[model samples]
Target: MKTVEVQNLIEIGLDGAEVEVSDPQGTGDHFAATVVWSGFEDMSLIQQHQAVYKTLGDYLTREIHALQLKTSAK
Candidate 1:
């Protein structure tokens, strides 16, 4: 999930942002994603995170187990 999410972030984030998604559990059951993006240019920090969260959708609601998000813009 981390790898896939990272790839998704990179795809959407373009060269504008640096992204990191981690799962300390090593079981892929629980996860945390930290994203830094310049694509946030005109958007507020919260909005930027909202964009990322929109991507994950039902995955977290159902099959993802547990997930947390930290997002920023630079």
Candidate 2:
């Protein structure tokens, strides 16, 4: 995926939060994203993970094959 797309995915996923995604796989299907956000402060780990997956929409059902996520609160 293009850099902008990755950026947008982060933006949308994190609710316009600032984040950077790394695609070590060099494939759009698999990606590692570092999400830094204040909104995550009091959220549960499952909630945090859900937030990211939520942004992917139907991608989880069909589209992207896999995603390895790394999240943090900033």
Candidate 3:
């Protein structure tokens, strides 16, 4: 639930992704992240978001309450 933990999970899941995460309200459950990876190339916006969500997996459903996500292809 910590910001670094979230960042680590995303980085691991997305392989060489560059991930930046922050807790905007200083609350552990709420997060904002920007993920950049070459694998996102050719994917639609929705698909890009889905990939990030999939990386978070069950944490998105349980530990994390909100995620303001932004993604881009490197």
Candidate 4:
């Protein structure tokens, strides 16, 4: 998927989230996302990643072959 589509999916799933998606090798299936959301304030690193994964759902395993996620509290 395109980075813009990934960004939109994340933004829709996480209210007030800031999402940045990139293709590391110019391969659309491999992506890296930087997600910032206030909801992560009290969550663990794992939880933060889980939230992102949950939002992306099947896209992560189906459309996206690999994802490098950087998550933070905003």
Among all candidates shown, the one with the greatest TM-score: 3
Give model 3's TM-score versus the native structure: 0.96
After aligning candidate 1 to the native by TM-score, how far in Å is the CA of 8 from where it should be? 2.8
Give all TM-scores, in the order shown: 0.64, 0.77, 0.96, 0.95
Better by TM-score, candidate 4 or 1? 4
Candidate 1 vs candidate 2: which has greater lDDT?
2
lDDT of 3 by residue, 1-74 (tens): 79999999999999999999999999899999999999999999999999999989999989999999999999
CA lDDT, every model vs. true structure? 0.67, 0.72, 0.95, 0.92
lDDT of 4 by residue, 1-74 (tens): 89998888899999999899999888899999999999999999999999988888999878989889999999
Model 1 residue 25 lDDT score: 85
| TM-score ranking, best first | 3, 4, 2, 1
Error of 2 at 44 (Å): 1.5
Per-residue lDDT of 1-74 in model 1, one digit per residue for the tens?
A: 55566447454745655667677788676877777776777887678767776666676666568667676667
Best by lDDT: 3
The positional error of residue 67 in candidate 4, measured at the CA in angstroms, is 0.7
Error of 3 at 30 (Å): 0.7
A best-first ranking of the candidates according to their lDDT comes to: 3, 4, 2, 1
True-vs-predicted CA distance for residue 65, candidate 2, Å: 1.4
